[model samples]
Target: MAKITYVNADGDSTIIDVANGDSVMRGAVLNGVKGIVAQCGGGASCGTCHVYVDPENTKPLADMHRVEDELLYFTACERKENSRLSCQLPVSEELDGLVVHLPEKQL
Candidate 1:
């Protein structure tokens, strides 16, 4: 299992324990973490599941696929180097204590 911390725009944090192979977006939705709408589920079609991964914790993540890369441009907030669609980020032991910063909105 891995523990992921999601920090909202206002600095509120929701920490969830997730199993390996579960997507970060799925973890948030399951735990009722705000700011992750996941409108398209884990399909990577909608950008509403956007999150800014802490730079230091990004090394373990797989490279973004073309679909997720393209969809990120449509997110509700400014895109950053650390920006990622939580739907595309699967959990793993290497990502324990991962920190994901939520955007101002996920609409």
Candidate 2:
């Protein structure tokens, strides 16, 4: 399991233990953590599960796929260097202590 931290735009932080092989979005939703909407479930087709990976994260994430990359352009929040789709981030021991910041809104 991996302990992931979800920080809301308002500064609230919630830490959840996500089982390995689950998506980051699923962890947040199941834990009832505010900020992540995940309108289309864990599908990268929707940008509702958007999040900003901690800029200081040292773990190596898999390179972004074309579908997620393209969908991010239409997110409700401004895309940044750390912007990512939580659904595309599968949980693993390597991602322990991962921190992701939620945007102000998801539409």
Candidate 3:
């Protein structure tokens, strides 16, 4: 299992142990973490699961897809260089202790 830390807009943090191969969005939704709407479930169609990967931990994540890259522009939050759709990030031993900061909203 990989331990992932989700930090909400207000700075509150929730840590969850995710099974290997689970997406970060699924892990957060399963753990009831607030701020992540995950409206499209695990699909890349919606950008509701947007998150900012800690700069120090971004290396382990897979490269962004063109669809995710395009959808991110529609997110309610400001998109940064580290912004990513959590559904695109798979949990793995390499991602243990990964930290993702949530945006102020997920509309």
Candidate 4:
């Protein structure tokens, strides 16, 4: 299992042990972490699962796809260079210890 750290909007952090192949959003929601609504479930259609990948670990994620890029534009929270839809990020051994900073709001 990979340990993922989620930093909430209030600067509180929650660490979860995620099984490989699980989406980051799934892990966060399963653990009942606040700040991640994931309103569209794991589908990329909604920007509710938006999260910012820590800059130091941003290079490993797959490049953003067109649909994800478009939905990101509509996110209620500000988007950053490392903004990503949590559902789009699959957990892996390489992603162990991955840290994501949640936006202030999801809607």
Best by lDDT: 3
Query: lDDT of all predictions, in order shown?
Result: 0.91, 0.93, 0.93, 0.91
Tens digits of lDDT, candidate 4, 36-55: 99998988998999999988
**Model 1: per-residue Cα lDDT over 31-100, one tens digit each:** 9998999988888988999999987775488789999899888898989999999999888999899999
Candidate 3 local lDDT, residue 79: 96
What are the clashing pairs of model 2? none
Better of 2 and 4 by TM-score: 2
TM-score of each: 0.95, 0.97, 0.96, 0.95
Q: Tens digits of per-residue lDDT for model 3 on 31-106?
A: 9999989999988998999999988874478889999999999999999999999999998899999999999999
Determine which window of 10 residues in candidate 1 has minimal summed lDDT: 54-63
Please give the clash total of every predicted structure, in order: 0, 0, 0, 0
lDDT tens digits by residue: candidate 2, 1-107: 99999999989899999999999999999999888889889878789999999999987687899999999999999999999999999999999999999999988
What does candidate 1 score on TM?
0.95
Q: Candidate 1: what lDDT?
A: 0.91
List the candidate 4 regions with Cα displacement exceeding 4 Å.
Answer: none
